[model samples]
Target chain A: MTEPTAVIHDIGYRHYDGVRLGRGRATLALGVQSLRGVFGFGRTTRAKIMPLLLMAIMLMPTVVSIGVMALAKQFIMPYPGYAVFMQAVIAVFLAAQSPYLVAPDLRFRVLPLYLSRPLTVTDYVVAKLAALAVALFGLLAVPITIQFVGELLVDLPGPPHTADYLGALGGAVLYAVLLSSVGIALASFTPRRGLGVAVVIAFYMFTAAVSTLFYAVLSSTGRDDVAPWALILNPFFLVDTVQSALFGTAPINDEGYPPGIAACLILLAVIALAVTGVLLRYRKAAS
Target chain B: MTASATPCFATEGLTKRFPRVTALDDLTVAAGTGVTGLVGANGAGKSTLIKILLGLLPPTSGRASVLGLDTATQGLEIRRAVGYMPEHDCLPPDISATEFVVHMAQMSGLPRTAARERAADTLRHVGLDEERYRPMGGYSTGMRQRVKLAQALVHDPRLVFLDEPTNGLDPQGRDDMLALIRRVGTEFGIDVLVTSHLLGELERVCDHVIVIDGGRLLRSSAIREFTRAEQTIAVEVEEGQRRLAERLAALGETVAAQGRLLTVQVSADDPGRTHDAVRDAVCDLGLSLLRLEQRRGRIEDVFKEPVA
Candidate 1:
């Protein structure tokens, strides 16, 4: 007589009978979405122009170098050197795209819907930062992979060549980590997408100009002993010094850059500060 | 409607103080399963209360729980079982509604394939035709609202918090949205806590109503109790309504004029005679009777009649 199942009525409402996932799957989804957003995937044609144009420009040098290798069995441009020559393009790409990923959510106030799910503020920050970094890595790695393939076809295989290729990939990773954390941390400040874009571009231009001016002034004033330190003010230069020390590559900005260990420490410290700033921004936004 | 014994959400001694003012002041309330209405003005802390219950914001002093889990300590668990549709614009302009809703479904932890299927079903349920494939930037206000509702329902949580869902809709759109809210509760068996600043907008949908003003709870009861039949008949005539009121008053009937309409009280012993008296009065005055009906109480009277 106590069969409760017999008394209950079945309504037409469809319930979710399948599995409900937890935080990990949710974070992964957000990360994958953000990454696709950076490349203008699943967006309008108007949204795809800037990223595609910049990506095309970034690969121009790779195309020319690969063509030269076709006529001769020699590698013209090193993998990391491609990043150095194209630092301006990479900076422009980050400037144009980082705000596209973070500004809309804040402008439209979409974080409330996101925070209402099983996701945390920290999870949000991690997913966004990781997505931007991975996007930047792809931007830098695609050319390198093409070159690696070209070298394999041309029999440019040796221990030094393999080591150099690996080191360049490592440098690309460093650039991605440093650039994305700083770019996203800065872009998350404003709610307007236009303001965010302006902020990121202004940040890059200001640092690059000031660092170059300081480097020239220090060297001309006979303070050559301290001129190499001015390069750290710029992100690309900071990354170059670390790559030079760690991978035994040539430094892009200054010949007498700091030692490998000190450069590595500074790189790690900047990344740590930028990531902490990102987490703090989301914490306030969620509240 | 499930016999869970506990209410859907409960808050005790809940108070939230900001720098300039108190958002929620010592509010203690519990809501049962069904369609419940949270009626308050813009600054009455409805949004603040939802945020605290979602575990996104911590109350200054108090404790709250949703679906029997602590909002402070078990926010993830609470959010896993609760859905929220924010009042503001939250959709990206360039993405299609289907794409955005499916992605949001995955963000709620549904598998990719299942997320797409549920997204399609929920979109159809919200009444978006093939237009669901177009970018949301090109959608009308009603279409956007449907997309917002679809995302909230795609995951199919046990409860949903819809803040001002009918805020910017036309009259017909308002009616359609109310019918949809009712269906969400009755047909789907999902508990709903919908809020509105206007008094009577939600009475047709919500089974229960809660009234709060200036961050204070005024009343909470079943909607039927809030709006029951009264012992008064409302009479609206094409002309000479004032003369009809005077004739009814002269006949020992308690009559009051509210603008062009009159409300006549009936004796508990002989209600049919009062109706006959009104009909006779309208005919003798030679005025066309535009309307004659027993008046039902309204939720607005909850604040008006109780204190008066």
Candidate 2:
């Protein structure tokens, strides 16, 4: 038998000599990728339908409100009331897309790939939460900004109106954080994306319906002072209460939204709980 | 960095206990640079040890370290330095290989441009070409395995832990995967800790062999040491093999003769003298020497023998 000769195949596996940005940059990369995922950036065309359709629905009111003001020479919808009017649309958007950001990773068992990187479990959870918050903020802010800009072009509502619009923008940031936190936290537990959507929507519907009924019952019985407390149960109501306090606008519900301090504390408590749940669910490196 | 003075990984009294079963029991093993084979049966704690080394799971007791960093305290640092390819499928179906690998490279701290470039290079290295742009849901098992391996190597980690890389491949596919793994260790100068349950699969590539049974270390040594030739020789003659065996036995060499072959046991202390005696005995008996060679021990022999 002839002796076998050694053969080398040069596949050109080059060593990476570039700088590694380490854990912070890894977390930032994760956050950016997840944010892109929420809108179906690398997904199929069909995957883009829900998020785009929801976004259009959320922005539709602002466009129609601006058109009404242009035709009738008056503000059709108050800037601070945007959250109150667009609550359901925005909630649907969050419910539909928040699961897109997290559930796939869990169901597909891709967390091991992420956890085995330079990233920690805290970085993983924080990056995902921060991504949802940023996406939700953009979703709520862009239309408000467009409306604010449109309002400026058409007519001058004066300095007070400008201040209110600015305040409403700030409150939009809070709304984004609170709403997205709750949506993502609820979606994190359910591994199936479809089931996650149901859980999120049900969470919103159940709390809003129960709280509204309780408020109506309490007000009819003449316990008006305690009726606002029922609004605390609904996340949308929490957004409205905080928006009213921040922009000095009238509350959306009949029972003037919860007292300012109590409302802010309740929103903070909800955000804290949601964030805690998210962190706990992803505490394992590869769950 | 190339394989440094320190070992690739080391564990001391490493034990992991699930609620119902003990996954690993007092596994104390260390491997230096080069391709080391971690051979074990299914459920033999190979995956468990890899997870602990990657800092994806904390050991229930004892201590372990990878690349000179503690698994518990410096997990992030260890992960940054090491890469892991899991035994099971973990690729997401919705994304393309280029997109997925770029995301993973960036998540390993590579800048965007670098991540993209490195991802392309990694894909090519793994033998993926234009098809990389297609979603991985359509990829075959071999292609999927290659994609998984590409992601593990895209970050240019110093060492890699590959578990069952040949788990679902045909004969040709397994051969190609093994060659790729060997090149990763030799050409790239990266240390590797590869696992397989097929005992003979690792024989051709690994420089060191580590055998584990039920999560405990069975044997640890260089591949040569494990498969070295024993103090025995096989003698084949054209004829009179029984007579020749009797002659060798008369010389006090323990002999067992087959039809035309004599199996002679040589003295461990004076093997060369025994060789001369056998040659002299074969010539005196007028038997033509057809073959004379020492018997090489196999890895299966160690399993048959007790720990000594």
Listed in order, each prediction's TM-score against the native is 0.90, 0.85
Query: By TM-score, who's the top model here?
Result: 1
Specify the highest-DockQ model's number.
Answer: 1
Docking class of 1: medium
- How do the residues A221-244 of candidate 1 rate in per-residue lDDT, one tens digit apiece? 999888888877888878888887
Interface RMS for model 2: 1.3
- The lDDT of each candidate is 0.85, 0.85
Q: List model 2 lDDT by residue over B114-170, tens digit each.
A: 999999999998899998999998999999999999999999999999999999999
Residue pairs with backbone overlap in model 1: none
lDDT string for model 1 (B96-140, tens) is: 899989988998999999999999889888889899998889988
**RMSD of each candidate?**
5.6, 7.3
State the lDDT at B39 in candidate 1.
Answer: 88
Interface RMSD of each: 1.0, 1.3
Which is the leading candidate under lDDT? 1
